[model samples]
Structure formats: structure tokens, C-alpha cells
Target chain A: MREEADVVVIGGGVTGCGIAYNLAKKGLTDVIVLERQVPCVGASGRCGGGIRQQFTTDANITLAMESVRLFEQLSVELDTDIEYEQGGYLIIAYEDEVDQFKRNVRLQNSLGLESRFITPEEAREIVPLLNIDPIAGATFCQTDGHANPFRVVHGYARKAQKMGVEISKFTAVTGIVVEDGQIRAVKTDKGTIKTNTVVNAAGAYSRDIASMVGVSLPNKPYRHEILVTEPVEHVLDPMVISFKTGVYFSQQKHGPIIGGIGDPEEPSSYNISASLRFMKRMARTVVELVPAFGHLNVLRQWAGLYDVTPDAQPVLGWTEGVDQFCQANGYSGHGFMIAPKVTELIAELIVDGKPSMPIDDLNLKRFEGEITGEAYVVG
Target chain B: MTEIVCRCEDITEEDILDAIDQGYTTLEEIKRVLRCGMGPCQGRTCIPLITRIVARKTGKSLAEVSRPTTRPPLQPLPLSVFAGEEE
Candidate 1:
């Protein structure tokens, strides 16, 4: 069926679904979201779902705080069990990063985040099995947590649909129809969708989606792989991050040790095959961080592409020379966490033409010279 | 007399071997042409069994056989699920 809408939201991941839901909730009904393949089939479901407010930049912190607040009330808000736990985020400061961690704690506190410096004894209390040796000081934040990404994304999409927002899954957005320096419509494999407003919320494929409209978004897709062990009895509570090893992990409520380390030199390609290099690095880092995880057998491993922008900051808002177009991509690897807030901001911008929060710092032009540097060195 | 590899689609060892002989190096290529493990459960229910068959037959190491392309819908939920069909 040929279709048209007030806004044509691209990609059915969490970010896209968030925009759709918020828009509909804010009284815009004629919105249709197009998903190439299926909802949460991209980076949303494949991510580690680590939510944190301890960030270095103002924009990142703002988005993360907003997202954490939304997530805290999301179970009742969405009428779906997202399994969000506010069990705090712990970053183990080992070796030389102790100084960096202290600086980060100061900045986070100045920004009114409830993060602090803790002794190794306090760190051991949170995670008993964690090897505290080679540790300087541990940075702790009570607000950071995790949720089920699939459930959250799907829940948002479901709510959007029930509210009269049309979501077409397995429908690929083939191209964008731009004319007179304005977005005319979006073309799909099935048919064409005529709309003035377009949101490029297409996760890892956001770069490709932007290119469809003749915009050069400086985002490259990088492969990041993660593995999970068989569910064990609850052995840990807080999620652990090592500034030294670039590894982050947490044992879920279902009790499978789930996490992945940042591979510094992951190439810009979609090669998601399980690699020996990834496995060895992940295994070594996880084992070193938590010695108790040594005995657990990894049930499976998988990979997904991170929509990495230069400087690892998210590129949000309207594209250059584009009318009625918005971008909520280039989140590096942190898309899953702040997706709700980011998408909500996009929705607000679409409906009210500006949000209550200041999204100016997150503008796409920041990559050129609008330097607002973020601090949270998370993967 | 090789055993069946793709437990989901029931494409056997001999079928995969013949496909390999025809130059299908990637599991995705074999899946596309032979429809081996591209069933309802995706390769989740079939991959381990297929990997054993591939490793034993080709004499490739387990690590080599373990490295298969991981596509989306990692858990094999229906497309209708994403469509919010409520079935």
C-alpha cells in the first residue's frame, strides 16, 4: 500500500521507536516508522545495555541523566517489564588512570552526579570476587545501571503502534527523496512514503541512511563482539568498568556474566564473524577483572556494528542544508543507553521545534569546530 | 555416509560436503544455496551440530568451524514479533 505521513521515522531500533512513541504521546498521530528488517535487529538488541550517567561531556551527561530517569520509571510508563536495575556502576581505577578517575569524579560531582572515590575495601564489598590488586582507587556512581534492550525497544515500538503510530517491519528504506533542499519523501523496497519530516535513527546504518539524502555524516560502523556465559547463581551486583583494560561487565539478574571489551583498533567494516582475536581479548579481560569468572563457560558469542563518529561523540539534530530532517546517530557504542532520551529530544524537536533541554551542544556541527568534549571513556 | 549436519533443515553432511566441493566456503553461502540451517530457529538449534560435522569432515579446527557469520535476530524470534502481531 502506498503511504504518507507527517514524519517518516527510519529504522525500528530503540532510537527510532523512542522518537515515534514520544511524538505520538505529544499529540502527533500521523507518524509512520519504517524498519529495514525488524525492530531491535540492529545494534539495540546486540548491545550490552550498560546505562551510566558518569560521563565527561555536558551533552553526554545530560542525555544519560535524562535517559536514566526515563528508564527508572519505564516499567510503569511503558506498561512493560523492561528489567531495568539501578544497581550502580563501578569503574575500577587501576595503575595510572587513578588520577584520571579522580578528575572525572570531580567533574561528575560538579555536574551534580552522585559519584565518588571509594577505597578498595568498599569496592570489594560491591563485587567480592573482583581482584583489587593493581588497583589505585575505584570510582563509584549509584545512578548507573542496565536494562533489557530488546524489551525496552520492543515495548516502545508496541506502545507507539497502539497509539496509532504505524510501524512497518521487514520493510527496508531504500532511498530518500529530497527536492528543493527539503525532504520530499522516503522510498522503501515495498513502496514510497511521502513525508516532509524524516528522522535518521538507523543505528549502525545511519551513515548509509544520511548518504541517501546527500549528507556526509562522519560515522563509521565498527564491529564489536560480546559473549555470555551460562546463567549462574547471582555472584555480583554492580557493573564493572576498567579504564586500564577497556572492559566492562556485569552479571545479569538471570545471572549470566555478560560484557565486552573495547578493541581499540576495530576496523570500519561490517565483518561480524566470531573471531579468535575477539574471544581471546574478551576472555582475558573478563578473567582478569573478575577472577571468579574464570570457571564459567561462555555459552555463546555474537558481534554487532558500533556507529562510531569521530571523537566518539553522538552527532544529533538536523543535517546541513536540510529542511525537516533530523539525525540521532553517531553515538559510537553508547546508543542503547541514551537512546530513549535522544529519541525523546528528537520527538520534542519535531513537535515543538525545540525541546525543554538544551540540544544545541549535541548539534551535528559540533564535529567541525563547536568543540564540546565529553569525558566518559566508556565503550 | 556422513551424518546430518543442519538439524533444523535436515540438510545432511553429504549435502554440505558436495556444496563445499562446489566451492561454498562460508556458512551463509551454504545456507543460501542448500537451505541447510536457515529454518525457524535460525542457526541456533543447528549451528553446533553443523560445526561438528564441518570440523570432522573438513579436518578444520574447531575454532575455524566456530567462526560463522552471525546475522541479526540472534534469538530467532519471529518477524511477526517485531511487527507486534501479538501471536
Candidate 2:
């Protein structure tokens, strides 16, 4: 815990670690990451780990596609096997959504992605046991996949540490010292670190950190629960996502079928408690999709927060009033998948004062008026 | 039969001690290393005992040794709850 640093990042989730790792690797000096809890102990660790580019919104598709490209080489670069499975993402559309699904697939194709629309039977060909009777069609993106959230977080943390970046865990940031409208220091539970730059990569806690500096982020934390079944013989290959049921699942290489469902009734709060409702709904939906997974014993069920914004997109770039305060929050549920690219671009923005990636459309001001194009969120 | 500290994860007192000996002093670290309270029950059954073990081993007061971060669903709920009857 130093008394001063060049930059103080306020979170230990994959976002913070990834930012720290990229900053340090990019030759930034005196960078320190302050984590209130252990690394990967937040939403970054609790997610379904699905990385996909099959999104209705261009912002999400671009971010996710770039993330997938980075993930393809992350294991070797970080020297840690992230257990990345590029098996593909299979999105099953119910009869009612076939038209909209085709439009999304067309958009994805125009964006240079290799994704395509396929018949439900074609989806069955990919997953073998999919219940295609009720599904009208599906979209397959071979580049989309899943990775180990734990390993990715740790890998970034370890690499950041190796690059002389100090990551102080169990140290909570209590306040932000903004003197004359510029970041002066970061006050933490452990100690205060004087710095000019502060990155709020706080995930669900981003709002709290932003409030410390009087910046209002429109992101709220919503609870999302997930469960893992006892490892069975590998049955599913691509991740099976359904828009109708709001459920998505994938069998990991080591065997457990891991997944979750989104509850529209879930309120915005800090609650991470698992709910019986989510488990049952997810189970029933899973069974309804693939009857063979009906009786698979659930090994564990847990909940995590999703930092959702008004348009279900992320709020990136520097704040309006704050000179050196940058935000990388409001990722909704896709933070882990887009972390590598997000953090890389953030580092570029912080270090070079401008990001090469086009992120002006993702600024915090988008929610000030009528937002456009609601992001297509699925299971 | 020997006593069990964490039933859901099948973690015993000895496993906790061995984890501490291996230098995983904190509850979260030990939990990660030994899967002590990371089962379906999510540490409700074993956290107190592990907290005591960690305190005793580290010679710190209960308050001095931090409890593992309590993540949500505080209790495991059935999948049926989220799956409504309309289905």
C-alpha cells in the first residue's frame, strides 16, 4: 500500500485486472489496483463465461468480436491456459422471433462475422440432443465461445504483478480526492494513494465510486444466478442460447453443464443471493430445450450482479466534469467476454489520451435523452 | 466416524488445517484452495468453523480474521422458483 501512484484502479474484477495488466504491459509506471475483495470474487468470477458476437446492437457486436479475437491468443500471451473453448455459440430462435433473428444474423454477416442462420434441424446437428421441434431456426457463430472466468482474472492479475503493477487486495477505496476538478488522490480503507488518474473499473460498485466524485452513472446492479450440474459425459458442444426462454447453457470441456437465466422481474440492487425461482426456471427451461439434461444433478448454484445501463450497453470513456477520471462500467452481463478488448482500449485511452477503437457512441451521455436500439439480451 | 466441518463440500477439519499450513491463511484463499465453503450450501454450514480455525491458527481475534465475502443467493433455491407455473 503505497502513499502515491501514477494510476489507482478501483476494482479487482477482470475489468480492473485486465486494465492494470494492459497498462503495465504498455509501459505505464506506478500503477496500482485496489480491490476490496479477492480477484475474480465479483461478477467477473460469477458469470456464465460465454464470449459471443451475435448481438443485435453494433456496439456490443464490435466489442464482443474484438474480445473474441483477443481471447484466441490470450492463453499464450498471459502464459496461462484460460480453458478457452471456441466451440461456437448456438442461438435457438422460437417461431415468433425467426424474422428478427434473420435480421440479426444478416447484421452480423455484414459486420464481417462468419455467423449464419441455420434451420433448427441444423442446430440439432451441432448439439445432437437439441429439441428443435419448437424452435423455428438458429444462428451459429463458430468464433463465439466460453472461457474460464477464474483463470482469466488470475492470469491478468499474475501478468500485471509480473509487470511491476501492484494489486492490493482486501483494500477498499473509501473516497476519491478530487481537488479543483481533477483526481488528486484515492482514499482507501488501507491508506490514501495520491494520483492524477483514477479508473473506475468497479463493476457493480462503479456507481458507488462514481458518486464519491459526484459523477452520476446510470448503471444499476441486478442479480443474475447460475448453476452447474455434476460433470456428465460430454454431450453438448456449442453453447445453447435461447431467446424465448431467456436461458443459455454450455457443457465445458471437463463436463459440467454450466449456465443461467435472466429474470425480468429482478430488481436493481446489490443482492447476490441465489434464488429458488431462478434455479427452477433455469432447470425447467434447460429440460424443455434438451430433455436429456432433465435430471442432471445440480452441483452448485450461485448469484452475481450485472451492472446494467439504460440501453443494456456499457458506459466507457472519460467523464464530463472530471479531468482524469475514466469509466469502464455498465457492462450489463457481457463484461467478461469483452474484458480483454475493453481494457486494452481503455488503456490506450488513458495512456495515449485517445482510443483507436470507436467508443464515442458508448459514452455516459447517451442516456441523457431518448436512447436508441435496445440491445438484444438473451439467456 | 470422524467429524466433518463442511458437509456439502465434504471438507473436514483436517483439510482446513492442512490448507492453513500450506499458507492459505485467509478464509477466501482457503476456500478457493480447499473448496471449504464453496459447495451447494455456499459456506452457510462451514464458514463459522473455518473462521474459528483460521482465528485459532493465526492467533487473531474473530474480528481480526475476515470472514469470506458472502456472495448471493444466501441459500440455494430450487430451479422451480425461477421457472414459473405459466410454463
Candidate 3:
């Protein structure tokens, strides 16, 4: 491992790798990415891979819209087949959520996202097997979809390495050497890398990394479970999600139906063990939504953590007391969906001293006062 | 003659080596990149074969290569089973 670098990014997941790739693309090649395990070994590899732009918050909607544009060209830009499918995302609404969804659709349409609130019958037209009896209304965004999270991480890491960025796997960050409120070096199990700038893109462990610099972050990790069924005929295209039950599912390009459900009772922790209760709840919810899924065999079940903040939004930009210590974690559960644009903006912030987009609304300082939480977060 | 390692994903020995050459040296890394152990069988048939290949190529002992994590339902089961419906 190199003893020195211009910048040292703390994780090698999609967020970290994406940031590294973007940094290198912008002429910052003397960078190193440290991963506790192999790339995509965290939430980046375990997510349901659904990318959507139908968020209730303007920050999330604008970020996802720009990310969708980047994802449309990511496969060609990274020189890898990321299996990106832009079939669209359908968010079903229950009786109580109808008004909220109407306002969300209006806000989304105002932001130039071609999202429209449709009837239950229209939703069934999009998803033929959907049980729309409980759906009061639905919103559809044709530009939102899913992709292979593993391939996305692989493409970013490979391209970043080819561009002369070093990626060190199995290297755990132990501490951060800070003097006079400026980052001087990063201590790891292998050796310390002398660097002036550090980006905390550590995903679920971002809070822990922040603590190393004596900066307290409010982000906490929450476990979410997902399952995939055996590869079958491609019946479903767009990802169908329900705001009422927090159950979502989509068919991969190769045919497996992958989905997940959120357990409201889940406590905040780093625990990612798959549970029988989650499996049962997910099975019941999915079958209740689409009875045809009961016939498919579940191949595997796994879990990943969502680095959640109080507002369910990501904390970006530089830290308050620590100079040159960039904060880029806390995506809640939608990191992969917005990674392309988020990483690009973060790179611009680090290299050009400013980002084109106005991200002051997403900084850690927002937590000091009253914040409006995002309402469209799904499992 | 080419040797097929993962029948579920139709992955050949050459495919595994290519993924390893691309810096995906571990069992889990190769599985994500190539889908060797992620098919219907869930690595039942291919895990052992791929482990040996990875050990030989990376000069690591069989015990040195970390085993693939075994997740639930051991075998494929209908969603109805978990949903509390009779098969």
C-alpha cells in the first residue's frame, strides 16, 4: 500500500467507488479507496437495485432525476454492461395516502419529472398481476427503474483503477489523525496514509468514521432484508412499490424477481442477519399484493443496512469543525439510486471548491433545527 | 474440452478464471461479478469447485479461502410455504 496519497476515500462500495471514479475523471488521480472487504460487499451489493425519481422531497427528486440521466449513460461511460433497465417505477397509494401522493405528483411534475397520478385500473394496466383493490391511486415515472448493483460497483472500481486510482481491499480504517482541526493522515490496520483530504463515504459506518475525527454524526444504521425468487419468464418490468405496506419488487433482466419489505419494529443497529420473521412477512405481503408470486420459489434471502438520518436524507459536503474532511454518507436506503450524481457533485465540491447544485439544504447543519422528513421511503 | 463449474448459471472454468484475473479473487466477489453461486442451486454444486479453482490460482490453501455464506431455506421453497400456505 502507498504511504501517501492526495486523498483517501474510506469505503469501496458504490458510493466510494463512484466518488473515486469521478475524482479521477476530474484529474485527481492520486487517490486511494479503502474497503473493509471487497467492493460492493455492503448495501451496494444487497439492495433491491430499484432506481426511482418519484420522491416527495425536492432534494431527493432533483438528485434522483440527475442520477437517472447519468445512469442512462453509465454503462457506456464505465465500459461495462451494468444491466440498467429503465422500465419505470410505480408507487401505489392506499386510501389515507391518496392526498399525499397527489401533492407529491404535483411537486414532481412541477420539477419536470414526467410523473402522473393514475387510477388503480391504470396501475393494473402497467402491472397485470397487481392486486389493485386496496390501491386508491398510483404514480408512475417512466424514467425510473433498476440496475445490477454489483455490476455498477464493479464498473466504477475497474474504471477508477484504470484511471490510476488505487483501491485497497481488506484494509480497515482505525483512526484519523487530526491536528488544528485539519486532517493530516488516515490510520488503517496496514499502515497510515499521509493525506490532507479525506472523504467519509463509508456508508453504514460513516458515523463511526466521523467519530474518529471527533465529529458526531446523527446517522444510524438500520437493517433491511430482501429476497430473490428463481429465474422465470419476464412478466414484470417496472418496479412496483406500495407506500402503504412498504413492499416493493421488480424483475431482473435475467428473470429473477427480487424484492424486500421494511419492518417498522426494526431497531437501529449494524445487525444485517436475515430473519425468518422478515422472510415470512415479505412472503405474505408479496403474495397478498400479487397472488401469482406465491407459485415462485424463493432462491435466497439477505440483509443490508440503511444509514438513516433524522430526515431520511443524505448528509453531504464538508464537516463543520474538521477542515478538508468531506462528509458524503447517510443516504438512508436510496444510495445506489442517486450515487452517480451525488458522487459527481461531491467530486466537484472537493476538486473545484464548489458544486453546481445547491446542496446547503442537505448538509449536517440542517439537523440543528426542525426538518421535514421524506415521506416516500420504501424498503 | 471446457469444464462447467456452475451449471445453474452455465459458468465455465474459463469464466471463473477471467473474473479472478479481473481482481475478483474471493469466492463472494466472484459470485457477485459472475453469478456463479447465486443461481437456483445457491452454490450447492459450484461452491466447492470454484473454491478449489480460486485456491489454486491465488496460491491460497483450501482452508484459507473463506467459505461462501449459507443463507436460509437451505433449498428452494415456494413463497407460499413461508406465507403459511400448504404446498
TM-score of each: 0.82, 0.88, 0.99
lDDT by residue for model 1 (B27-55), tens: 54465445454454556766776676667
Off by over 4 Å in 1: A370-372, B1-87
Off by over 4 Å in 3: B85-87
- The candidate scoring highest on TM-score is 3
Where is the poorest 10-residue window by lDDT in model 1 chain A? Answer: A370-379
Q: In terms of lDDT, which candidate is stronger, 1 or 2?
A: 2
True contacts recovered per prediction: 0.00, 0.24, 0.80
- Candidate 2: misplaced stretches above 4 Å? B1-25, B30-87
Docking quality tier of model 3: medium
Rank candidates by lDDT, best first.
Answer: 3, 2, 1
Give each prediction's root-mean-square deviation over alpha carbons: 10.9, 3.8, 1.3
The sequence of per-residue lDDT tens digits that candidate 3 reaches over residues A3-43 is: 99999999999999999999999999999999999899999
**Candidate with better DockQ, 1 vs 3:** 3
Report how far residue A5 has shifted in candidate 2, in Å. Answer: 0.6
